[model samples]
Target: MSEKMKKIIKIAIIASLVSSAYSVRAQEDELSNDSHVTTSFVKRQVAQNMSIGRAVKSIVSNYPQEASAVVSTALDMYPDKYQEIIHAAISAQPMLTEDIVKIALEKNIASCANIVKTAINAEPSYVDFVVTAAANSTPEELNEIVRVAVITEPDSADFIVQSLAQQHPNKIVDILSSAIEAVPLVGEYVVETLLAIFPNDAESVVSTAVRESASERANVKRIIETAQNFGLDEESIYKYAKEGGATDEEITAALSEATEQR
Candidate 1:
């Protein structure tokens, strides 16, 4: 097997071996001392497709502390098991990831890139994880995140714009607006990203707003109008739409209007 597959398997094994002991206090060298910080703890478990999700869920429930190691080892040992772990990440409550994911986000994109590449290879469907990790990353790190996120999940224009607005507001607005204009179908995501900019609309409009407002303003308006449009809603729109009285038709019409604005 390839080296990447080997790492994932190791992590899956660790997930299988985890116990519910109140505490595991051992030396850094020996997991018996610290369950959250060792390679051996990961080697003892067995995570099949059926159990992999649960195992991953358990580890992520303890995220950052669990770090990229669990998924890393799992991809190494059970390459086929990566997606199961990512799905668990998606559905598992209290979303979290290995500390290495954060360290990489905080310190260097290369570090995070290595881990995310493993995730992408093992679980191609979970490319969004890379996008998400980039989104949550610090400012200097965002551009690199955006570069990778777009390459990995090109369909996620909103993620790209959001990253630009959230991280490099000064240079990003016009650039992103141009991208949105070029790809009008998903222009709403750009506008949405604009809204997400701090100081709110002021930041968003500074980009392609006034210049493109006449032609693209409607599209831009739809996404920035509501606080939720800017991702500031009390609850996620997806969940709200599920529970709210608005019908699918209503939402679709709204989206259509937004898309047709420019």
Candidate 2:
């Protein structure tokens, strides 16, 4: 072939190859965009049609960290189905409960307390996480949470109280007082835990329990016994108890009983 014809043929071949490569690239980009849009639409439909339980299972099955965000959003959108969704999600993926609770608290979700309470109630074993999360809440909110926890799960009261007390020693008296008030039966356990952790604050703890729990005679007796067992002097116990509103008759009877025991 002539040189010019040969060169023309080679140029045409190169041009054709370049055009084919551009067409393939354009097609790939279009396909990529279509795939993304289709995936997103499917996800939305799945979310809308599936039950919250299935939605949660699907999300947490792969994206565990997104559990809280998903739950929080679900709660905002479905106020009426609050408990149902929460229970369903937690029931489906128990491990995600902690993440759900932590995110709820971090975001200051209004129903954080109820969520924690429900989570703990459903699985008492999560009490530690629930209590820890509640510790970050306002004092009043924390108090209410503690009250509900102690009242509902009295057995978990000791652990809950101890965790909060250790975290906020200054609030020990108030926390214990609330716990004792809710379930006076927990008073003895509270006293024992308090004295073990805050021996120096024993007087304050006893006085608060006595003053606040005077109506609860059994609780008062438990406090007095706990104080005595901790080696607090009889006079100091009586004086604090008196200052805490123990009746003269109640103090005398308690001290007399203590002496007999000694």
Candidate 3:
């Protein structure tokens, strides 16, 4: 597995454990009084700022360790404001290992990396901060952040693949394709992590991941054939075939099986 994939996955697993630890205690009826501030007050302060992005940065920068709390405040101040700033930051830094890419990409929600890339280049160290915070974010938040960040830095393939392989191998199976070109090492990881995640989509994701340039030629061919013989189909078959570079016969085999099932 690539180092990038490892780091990303590591963050995901860590975030999951941490969130689960607190979720049970945060009952819906239990109103947040201390660390959890209200949203309206945040909006009023954001309005006084020059720009929403700047306003967000001001909070995170000044707070340092409180980046998460500050962002929460910013969102309460302006719902989704934090996401917008993240989008801007990721957009600006395509090459940086945006630890938050998965924050946006989880659960199949499409993200606009172009918008996030704009702010990434403004500061390289911000990459580290985003990565750390992104790791701390909840699964849902991580998914959203990733959906946006992946598109923002679609070129950081190594980071994406390794992170998932080691941390959240389950999720990496599907969405690692966006940056395969930039991080060739991750292609193999994509296949490996897909197999590890072992969800309904694993077969398809693994089949496709094998076709990436980083994939071993023999391994790619083997997975494509396995997918066809196993009878996967539709989006699953499409995904596998898309990556496998399967010939007409191979694709037809998978499609035929899917068609029969339907």
- Winner by lDDT: 2
TM-score per prediction, in order, is 0.41, 0.70, 0.39
What digit string (tens of lDDT, one per residue) describes model 2 on residues 1-262?
9999999999999999999999767634533452321333324534775765565555544444455655666655555656655665666567766666665565554565676777786567778667766676545577777787787689988888888888788888779878887888888787778888888887788888787777788678767877887788888888878777887777777767766887
* Cα error, candidate 3, residue 207 (Å): 5.7
- lDDT score at residue 183, model 3, on the 0-100 scale: 45
Native-referenced Cα lDDT, model 3: 0.48
Tell me the spans in candidate 1 whose CA falls farther than 4 Å from its real position: 1-32, 35-44, 47-51, 58-69, 79-81, 97-132, 135-163, 174-183, 192-262
User: What TM-score does candidate 2 get on C-alpha atoms?
Assistant: 0.70
Candidate with best TM-score? 2
lDDT value, residue 260 of candidate 2: 80
- RMSD values for the candidates in order, in angstroms, are 15.1, 11.1, 18.4
lDDT of 1: 0.48
How do the residues 1-262 of candidate 3 rate in per-residue lDDT, one tens digit apiece? 9999999999999999889867535422122345553455345446777666665555444334444444444444444454575553344333332433433433223333432343344443354344334544444444444444444454543444445434555555434554343344445444444454455666557645655543455444445444444444456755656565755565556456544655
